[model samples]
Target: MKDKKKWIIGISACVLLMVSVFFVFNQGKSNEQVVTEYFELLKKKDYKQMYQMLNSKTVYTPTQKYFVEKYKEFYEEIDAKNIQIKILDEQDNVIEYLIYIDTLAGRITYRNKVGVKNEQIQFNKELIMDGYTDGCKIKITTYNPEKRGRILDRNGKVLAEDGKGYSVGLVKGKLNGENDYGQIAQYLETDVETLQKKMSASWINDDSFVPIKTVSEATKNDLINKNILGINGVKISTVSIRTYPYDKVASHIVGYVQNVNAEDLKKHKNEGYNSTSVIGRSGIEAAYEEKLRGITSGKIDLVDKNDKVIKELCHKEVKMSPQDITLTIDIDLQQSLYNEYQNDKSASVALNPKTGEVLALVSTPSYSNNDFVLGLSTDKWNALNNDVNQPLMSRYKQTYTPGSSMKPITAAIGLETKAIDPDKDLVAKDKWQKDSSWGNYYVTTLHAPSPNNLRNAITYSDNVYFARSALNIGKDNLFKYYKNLKIVEKIPFELALNKSQYINKNQKVSDQLIADSGYGQGQILMNPLQLASIYSAFVNNGSIYQPHIVQGQTKTWIKNVFSKETTKTIKEDLINVIVDENGTGHAIYHDHVILAGKTGTAEIKQSQSDTTGTELGWFTIMTTDEKQPILMTTVVEDVKNRGGSGYVVEHTKAPLDLYLSQVSD
Candidate 1:
């Protein structure tokens, strides 16, 4: 009896639908108005209102939540905006209409029909997508995976690319028992017994080319020469891998790729990433990941409730070719900087002051990015990770005290705030203190020149002069300058940089600390890029142009942070630092080209009384010659015992001379 009643109800519903179809003849206008209202709601992206107008009693009708979610998801997926709808005609309870919507994929127009029942919309796949049937499945077809994008220099020199490397193989069956496996191990700088144990599996066949290790280019040639039939059984095989052409020269800038790990999979979950995928680990590879990876191309298909062969919904996938990242770096200059500072624990950044493009970035004791891509052994990986010089670290992004390089900036701030009279002399002595506030510490100058003034102080790197200048500027006023210079706010950059800080977190700015910071010591620390940007302000009419690595439009991070007069004053003083015979920066003076610069020696110590401490040498310079208007900031560790800031000055001159001579305006 229950089955009979259910059949009766089903028949009754069919009858009602037929009645409604007939009823639509006279109520066509009303149904058309309701459809128009439904389309209007869609145009406004009012999914809830559109769902409320849907015929709830329709068979296979989804829940209200699902109804709303589907519409929202479809619209969002298409990035639909600026929707327009028009009625075409009316049929037996079905309204034909046209819709034009703007989507992220671009503008699209389509025609479809929706059934109107009792003045409510029959919302289904047809309403969502033109000509697509309800209760259908999308049969997705994936396009073949393409190569990840190449990292290139400004002139398209490959930095990182998809390439191949050779592996050293051992055919166990061909190896004579008395042969010198120890000799091969010695060649690889590895233990012979361990190498033998790993390759000596019982399942080895005669034809098996078991890979012993990936050999370096130098080692691969030696292995190829030694590949004999019976003795060592060493064979070389080429395997595909990501390769860094410039290797350690561009390691910190180009970075490297590695096979996706659990963490990577988890972080990029459901984004078409899997175990076999390789993700960028750092540099441009990491920064422009999605762009380099390219979009997945696929097709959508429509099906019915009973799973029948259906028409294709959409034929083409959203195909995006893997985009190459072109950096603004001049690779030759990058190499030059690397060659100049490779021996020292140093970091350097070169920038086009006129355009704000980062010309090059170099960090010494660099590691080969290729090693990571080809795969690192436990020992090799641990050695790189545990190295004292931090071969794998990116020092360009790390913060170091700007030292006396901060003097010129401090002078700018003081001049801007009217705290210093540029023409008048500062009463800075060889040693001085502010009221001797119960302490044994005093602000001292490295070199004492009679009648110390702004130009003389900068020329001599008079620390006491700048210390008194900071006191005159005061905390509030000094911080005001820092805020304008982007020193307070984080500078927007693709690669992460530790923000330059004036003091430790939550630490109050004491008088002594402020005085020390005035000369780039105390708690003040600066990223190489930030210091380069700050130096750029002098040549940029007192506006700091933001430093960018990727090739693109130049933008100013802050405009007019310093007045033109103030910039001119400081800029001239910097030039004097290089031009004057007595200046600390005169070591880099050239007869043909005038270079504006400042030399800094920042002391690092646990306490004021600590005699055992290290000093970082900093040489920051901008070209005064119009034809070569670039600036660079270089900082090297342990310059205290080796001529202090003079070490950096002497090393940077030749490389920059080469770069300037080769580059045309």
Candidate 2:
């Protein structure tokens, strides 16, 4: 009887334990179901269903419409395209889940908590949405405009750098009284009337905060901290101002930045560029913009019911920092040239004859690059556009009559066609007699010496001698030589080059035209770059090196324009032009460095309205150092003097001296 009673007690105890286990298991399952449903609805963007799952007795009670909008805003704030969730753990009425968000910035993960009681769901609603919950809140913070890449010269000197600044703006409707204007003006260091005028720009409206001026980064902070500028209506924020440290020195090569316009936005929208972003407008800045622009990223916050942010989470930076660019330019050389010629309307280019590495490219009358950095004022814009000197124009792209500079090419052609002998003497006359077919055409001689050889002809720039050589070479051979030399051929430059035109094949070529062309007259127009490039052949062993401003040498050579023997002979003759007593460039000749080059004086016709004809004086000089050859070309415009090439040679000495003393080192 005792054994049977013990068995019955054991069986009843086991049954009670089983019933307790069943009830607890069902309760936990219910909690998990409600928690899972809440998150699943949130993932589906079914904010209404998610709101319904929330206990109505909750303290964080936002209306259904508000709940939906709040979630919508949260989705927008996160910039997320997708949301994924997984059950992490469950204990009685408490549940935890891992939420993964796929955003434009990157993936974001969160460990979220949910509670259940009496099978009713309860949680901090603001964790996924934004609004005031008793203990729940959401906050969004942005850490935008990370550091941008720098633009550096080949020597690693900074050319473009980020400068700390701030935009000072006023809320259109925030100014309550006249005293406000005075307070703001004092902080801005301006008069009240001027400040008012600036604030009242057309772009500003009653609800707008229009920026008036940019101040130093420190100044912006000081005003905000002291509230000295009447913060009630004033707006200030840290900003990155792209500054060209050298300003006007390398303006054309380094380029400038401007606010992105509608066109730029439309073009680069897919590249993540916005209307407010600054874009490279010209030069290297425009060319390498993709590598120079900065990437944007920000932070997001979760707020509690008391309007307090509970957590701050940052989004991963979408793009790496902009890469700094290293250019092949020598800034010191560039600046020196700018200093010497900034006031003039002329252009100069220096390059390595063998490799075609441009040492310096100067186009004078340059405006300050900073003028375009922040924004260009209308008055300044109008001035740049109206200035007759056309300061912005790069003279390398503009063609002008090359004058006697073409004599060397003619000499090369004469040598190639076997029309003239280097050792043979040719008679140079005072002037060419008018031909019956040429009508009034007459070619004058600048310098005349009897029994002039090829070397003497080039040394004295004997026009009649070259004219006779061109006639001897005949029209077809001369034309063929021009084609071989690529005189009017379109140059392959990273920068655009204007296509040069030769005498039209359809037009009749008279004897005078051929003679005039021989001495670089009568419709012979070539830019300074083109002439410099052709002249490089003399030092490059009769091979033309494509001219380039960037670092890597193209090493492009047009070979066999003249025989090695002929090239040697022609090169020596050009050397005589600088060293010879009768040479046009003899005025600036120096014994320290052996110089070889030619001088030109082209008579440029003025507008038909003006009677005074101007002369375009040109000189191309080169160092004879075989290992370190430097070639320089200079042109002076509108010279009204008979000194001609001689005057140019004298005036060009200072810059050349500077270059030799400084750049050679």
Candidate 3:
């Protein structure tokens, strides 16, 4: 009886175990459950886990490395973001789902199906629902790059243009490679080995641009000057690249271009910039980079193993064509001005006083901007950057004392405040001091008029007349007129200018400082741009035209900075400064063009008694003829031993003459 009871208990335990096994097999994960896990891994970009979930049964299965690389490369190139997946439907062992991916190129969305086999997902190259890159590669299709815009002058003279260059390279057809390698190396200034490897390129044809080293116009001239073109196989060819026609003539205004570096890549990430891309480095090129560069348009393609295009996966249509930029500058005037001051450390600004359009902006001792375009050699770059002359600096944007140029402005202020009576003589001496409080400090002048009235003061550039005027107007009222010139305020311009200031930091406050400033010396500063514009107020009926480099309508910046009476009186005084036989600037007087001008000299010294101080010479001139109106302000450093303000006047007359001859109604 005991043996029969034990045998029945064992059979009951076996029956319970069989029931549990059947229940577990029937409840195995459905297709939806398994595929959901696979997509969860996909959304995370967990390639390893996602690959592990893919079954090996499909012919479309790619190796783990290929899969990971494809996703990474394509996704990175597109700047993929915000991936999402949702189950759509299920049939048998297959599960259908919608996948959405956002990319820099655009958003991608599609419906895809996946198979679940034994709780594992089947691989489908078309899983993204876009045609799978199978037996094909991801191909990048780039359009003809937008032609970078040209920088043009008022008459459409091109200063900087795209798709033009002089490429100095070897001509395979002409290369007598045997005996000519040495001569070629010498002319190209490159070693023989580099040429050899470059020439040995399997695809080299007679017309190939072998070595294709682009050269600046200056460098091209150097090659000609050195007689380098006589060598066998050496040739210069026109190629597609950025070119500066005038080279250094407008370098400070046009700037240059350079290949994008790591810093630029970081700053412009996912903004269509790459390592090979070129960017504007300074000047108008940099200021209007977006407008000049336009939009980068291209497409992505899926190609077969043989490199034939299977289909286009993404396409970016061209939107904005590069726009040509037209400036108010007359290239001829710019060239003429640059040439006149090329050898000096000087800055010049020329403007249409009637319209306030900047005609020319010149900074002397300039370096060729084209050198940067073709890629500057380290030695050349270092030489330019480290040169004592600072050829790279834009001098017009820098500030300096206005010297006697401040006299007219000062007289205007005095007249506005009723501090000066034009008809009455102030009875000031050529050498003067306010009182015994001035101590040893005395204000002196080069010329003392018979009557120190307003007209004679301006005509002779009397320092004492304006120095006493500063004390009359007082500091509070003094800087008020200057403030209208944008002094202490940012000048609204495309390019930046260092702020003009008075009473510099840590400067000792005293009547001497104020008196000195009255004559345009004591810690006073103004850039060529501000001086030119303020001088415009003298001719513009006591108002200043807003300065602009672009061809735009004349906009009044500050209205009624001076009354018309003050401007009319000052205008006559300035005209006398140039017209009078005894005037200081009479040296530049023209018969046909009634030029009004002032000459000034700012003494730079370490101490009040320093006799060895340098002087910055200034000459500000403008046409009084309304039909052909132009204003030019010029300054040159270290003019003490060089003729003082007379030196600046002499140099400025050349460009002024050239412009007058070229002017039209």
lDDT of 3 by residue, 3-94 (tens): 99999999999998999999998799878888777767766778777777777767354577877777666666666678777888888878
Local distance difference test scores for all models: 0.81, 0.74, 0.82
Collision count of model 1: 0
Error of 3 at 188 (Å): 2.9
Per-residue lDDT tens digits for candidate 2, residues 1-665, read 99999999999999999999987776664777777777678777888887877777772655888777777766755666577778889887778888777754566677877788866677575356433344444454434355557878768888887886778877778777556877776676566787678766788778787776676555567877877564577887667788887877887777888888899867653345565678888877887776777555545666665646666554556465577877766777777767766776667777778877777777778877876765554567889999998878876667778888899988888888799897788766787754666555566786877677898888889988888888888889988877777767887665566755557557788777788888887667777777887788887778888887656656765777777676777778888898988778887788788888899988877542445778888889888777557787877687656467666677567767876886567
Indicate the TM-score of model 3: 0.74
- What overall lDDT, based on C-alpha atoms, would model 3 receive against the true structure? 0.82
- From the highest TM-score down, the ranking of the candidates is 1, 3, 2
Q: Candidate 1 vs candidate 2: which has greater TM-score?
A: 1
The TM-score that candidate 2 achieves is: 0.68
Which of the two candidates, 1 or 3, achieves a greater lDDT against the reference? Answer: 3
